[model samples]
Target: MTDPLVLGPLLRHVGETTASVWVQTGGTATVTVRSGERSWSARTFVVEGFHFALVLVDGLTAGESYEYIVEIDGAQVWPPAECEYPAPRITTLVKDRPTRLAFGSCRTSVPHDAEHHGSHGVDALRTYAMALADGEVEWPDAIAFLGDQVYADETSEEMREFIGTRRSLDEPPGEELKDFTEYAHLYALAWSEPANRWLLSTLPSSMIFDDHDIRDDWNTSWTWHEEINETQWWHERLVGGLTAYWVYQHIGNLDHDALAADEIWSLLAAGAGDSEVDLTAPLRDLVERNDRHPEVYRWSYTLELGDCRLVVLDSRAARVLEPEARHMLDPAELEWLAEQLTGDVDHLFVGTSLPFLLPPGLHDLEAINEVLAAGRFGGLPAKGAERVRQIIDLEHWAAFQSGFQEVFELVMEVARGTKGDPPATVTFLSGDVHNSYVAEVIDAEQHGAGSRIVQAVCSPIRNPMPKGLRVAMSGFSRSLVRPMRWVASRSRRIPDPAYPWRVTHGPWFDNNLAVVEVRGDGLHLSWYAGEVVDDDHDHPRLREVSTVDV
Candidate 1:
């Protein structure tokens, strides 16, 4: 390959008249994106020997479709001569149109073969891409990948092969990512799949990281943090993970104004308009500062899609883990969330990596576990509780009762019309739970809010739960109903939820992706999966698994 373009021409933020394109290149070169006679160009920025650019395409007609091509140093690099699909199109959002949002999480990178399919199953996202490319389904306004886009702790055979070349196979951390270079390779492997790559190039997508993006149970608690901080490889891993995430995922999340306001963007674009900017040193400082003080930079982002307002929160990196003051979000982050929870929009969607409303019994169990881990029962029991917390992944909104309650209070305020006119529906879109389910705040303290507060969680776009866990989760969803109320009521440390909820639609265990369409009456939600018919792995068919109207 003589092209400098390495990874992406990913369509990031797109508005009525503006769009941003992100690309990773193999060398220092000017990246240009052209639509018809109009072209936009940006010089490459270097981060640890890696070159990238985010070029903004503007002044386009609203609600119009424009086929775009990528050029490196004025030579077309995208839509390679051998490409089978059409040239990627930048379709800007149409004002007043109902928004179609697709979301999922927890996908693993692996070769698509019979052996891997026996475990991981078909990639629903890729199948969706194929369908979209073939005009079988309507295009979504955007897709928000909740988390685990790449697993840092769980390496694939390809990742392990790369890791083996870099470090000793028998060493500590082993196949797990060690630094920025490894993390870079991991992202490349994750997004390089052909159908998925073409889908991403054309679809405006936003993302947030969950624990597996760095490591499982990342920032789960203060004790967990203290232990990881003591490790030799962790510091580099932390910095590298954040650095790669910023370069790969975070920058594309912001629009024109938000990108201009970003500190890192400002530094890279400071005085060098046309010259190449090397941000390796600044990136290291950024990751170090952000890890030491989580509030230094905000990973959370907000976007507007027609009548919908989407606020994607950063539930993993920015957290208060200390037992005395544990929260899913820190003080500043909580305040920001409160502000963003305002109404005035027809639909408000909060995208969290972890589900805000889990199964009632499991939620109460987590609530009690948080207290027990903090030495509520005894010192010895606290140790046991801490170990159990990590074992079953007991960290979620319920695990941090204070943050959970406070955020709910803010949500209630918006629902009650305090912040602004209450939205028709307040939906929390999430992944990372490995299963798909829908829950609704029902028959509790409404406090004058007529809005439908719901939680729609879909996950593991490629990975599937074992039959054993599927059975356990199915029974867990139904059986936890009545007793969990009593279980939660008994704990004085755990106050009753401001709004009681129940699982309304499903606890479906499938390798699936879900979509939410903002309609006139209410919201329509559906989950779909890729079914390999007749054992045809190369041409999986997209099938709808379930549908629910909110």
Candidate 2:
């Protein structure tokens, strides 16, 4: 019999005593996850013509592992017909054990064939999956997909074909995702790859969206927003992206209690037994509401991993772009984040889609652009600066000087033990730029801050920058450092960063995944890339690119 299941039996939000399993079904049906003699089931909730269920499997033993199978409407559909890999397992977190996490961003869902490999590079997550299957590395406690898991604007050939079947490609937003249906298709393309799917099933994963998840340079500035709002297609794109995100990614990130507390989720889950309750109207309205008032909902959340704390922030949304207050995060989000930054953990990790500390060279350039766009020169030049900012991707944490200063001061306070006992390592985990690296923070006054503050960036788990662009980036990181800093010094408004930083390990431009282990009082970081052995284009072996113990 054909499987009624769709994208996942994805393991999400595993804890010491519980785990959540999320899935999409073909129709209105009950989805059950069974392991040994115990089983848990949830009736699918329908939304945007799709059925999904996030089952909270309780009574799980701490620090123990269990293999599970999925059944839909009482028929075994998962571990689909002669599966070769190990059965999907959930390994709950131990009380004092440090969390091992794998993270990366910017993957495009293209075919994994030779031609695609030539264009996109080897898929790092796929290579990691194959390596784990062969027992080459330890499995991470979780994987944080920082952003760009699906590129709605830069549609792949497969996505375009699927889009064409239901909607004309010659429309206003040609080759771009049109509505909730198309966004659903895009998620399927991203997650349904055999090896990657198996990996996600066995490994608990969380995600946050970045610009490309909706459109290029999403919410970059007031100018960008005003321009896009005038377009015929922007509203649909925003609605589709946020709606699909809520159903597919955001809901799964919550724990049992958190999920139950969610307004839309609780409302939809109430209709579970009724079988695929049409959620089209509510979902559309919710997305529209969020677009107009981002402060009403937050996509950011946190998890406590033994002695380490992980805070995954929503950097793309919850932004304030008005001329009087340009911020990467709105006041509400900032206040919430301020409260979360208090420390009593061994290591504190902030997972954001955009890096907190960009390379010094790149950081200075963005700072200069912020002042230019804020009318430092004149109206005409400010207009030009806004256009240039979008063209060059200058919208980063450093671009909002006031917001950057405030957050920098907050982090500095945490490092100095103002909130509580300072953590040994204050780390920022991020990805967006096509390259990867580590940068260590330095206090200007030479004060002993008592924490190893650093940035660990990993990007492009699949997509690689084109050669010319790679060359330009490399030149910027090296040749333009001094010149950029010199330019930034002219603007009194762009003050020196709270703490200047320098790249320590890499600027490697490889399709890569970075694994970080919270080992005692420090972080053990490693970056791995895929190397094709013996011209085997289909299978790439994991190769260690760099390792840093901080």
Candidate 3:
């Protein structure tokens, strides 16, 4: 029997004309996608020695549905013969008509039960979202996974076991992923949830990777990259992981035009011929160079939804790490980002893997990190410098101060309606910090501006922060964090403005899921946590956290 083929990042566009489906598997497979009566097949491609497919179906109507399937070794696969088709199995992209999108990231397949279940739990979020999309609940316009969709550093017990079964964990890379095979299995764990798989078959998704997708702190600084590259297997590991990430996750996010213009895309298209081509070598070189010199390419892009615009920023992989001009977004990427947000739109949504604003106290700690990172504290001793780098690796938006400041100022312009025809609302949807919360930009009048700038964060649909770290974060946020920001700035040694963040919305506690609805005059955002009831879960409930009025 042939291994089942899996598809993901279902999306539609290109003149309300074409649809694309990304597939990965143990071997080559044939995918058949149908929109209404039209059907299509994608030529197979390989990256990092893994076989995958991208099928594009043409003649789709906007806001409509379609069905698709896969066949390997002359056997039909996907939504297995016995499985039921979810509602809206395939949908054409639509405009600003109350789009219900489900988005979150940072998932680890631990036991949903309290027994610390050893087996990787079925993806609860994926399951719920699928069932909801199927019939249990309503479907969303799109699904956006902000970051850490796969954990390269923190593998689950099951993943560890799988790795151990395949190779020795006592080696230098020990328990850390080091090649294409390891990365492949990591993806299997990530996408194996049936509901999530089903959801992927239908819901158009936009994904951007975070650190855990590669390692704990993949690229916080030049030093981190240097250390990792110095390791015997680090080069292979980074190259393989990033190449697979690009082939698997990143490419699916684009439409036909973007894909057509991509250099790698052209290579893959050309390589679709009979004799096999090794995409890994060149792909590896590209990823490695991207890490070392982020300005060479553009990983960030913009998505237009009728009157609304979604600007997905590449917080990682596009950093300017020179000591003098450290930044989260390289100059080129920042320039592009600024230009995108400057465009006139009704609603502007910025998708970043890292939250732009943390709790006020934590925001202050980030400033301290800047000083420490600058070697301003304790004379930047060897030990202290390593420690500071680690801190920068841990939280983001501060690691690249110049880039962070530039993005901040740009968004602030949109929030204040600095442009002649400003976006009615500037909403940022992000994930990465294991916990989730919502922050609204308070207007001078203090009413949650309806279309006023707002931020909604949802994280770890499966992953949970350790209780100790959670406690530390809470205590630090409430007590020492704010004071330190004040004292540090007042001392004038490394003065940075204190965060004007007022938690008028929440500091909600939980490994939760969230949803945001954009109606005419208001924005409705809510969160839910997983609760196992009767051996299953019913915790995907939406509890209103807060509302903002313009």
* After superposition, candidate 3 runs with Cα above 4 Å error: 4-15, 71-75, 84-88, 111-114, 117-124, 130-134, 271-278, 377-382, 388-394, 416-420, 444-451, 475-482, 493-499, 537-550
Best by TM-score: 1
Off by over 4 Å in 2: 443-445
Task: Compare candidates 2 and 3 on TM-score and give the better one.
Answer: 2
- Best candidate per lDDT, number? 1
lDDT of 1 by residue, 341-435 (tens): 99999999999999999977778888888988999879999999999999989999999998898888888888888888989989999998789
Ranking the candidates on lDDT from highest down gives 1, 2, 3
Q: RMSD (Cα, Å) of candidate 2?
A: 1.5
lDDT of 2 by residue, 56-103 (tens): 899988899999999998898878878867889989998688779999
TM-score of each: 0.98, 0.97, 0.89
Error of 2 at 361 (Å): 1.4
Better of 1 and 2 by lDDT: 1
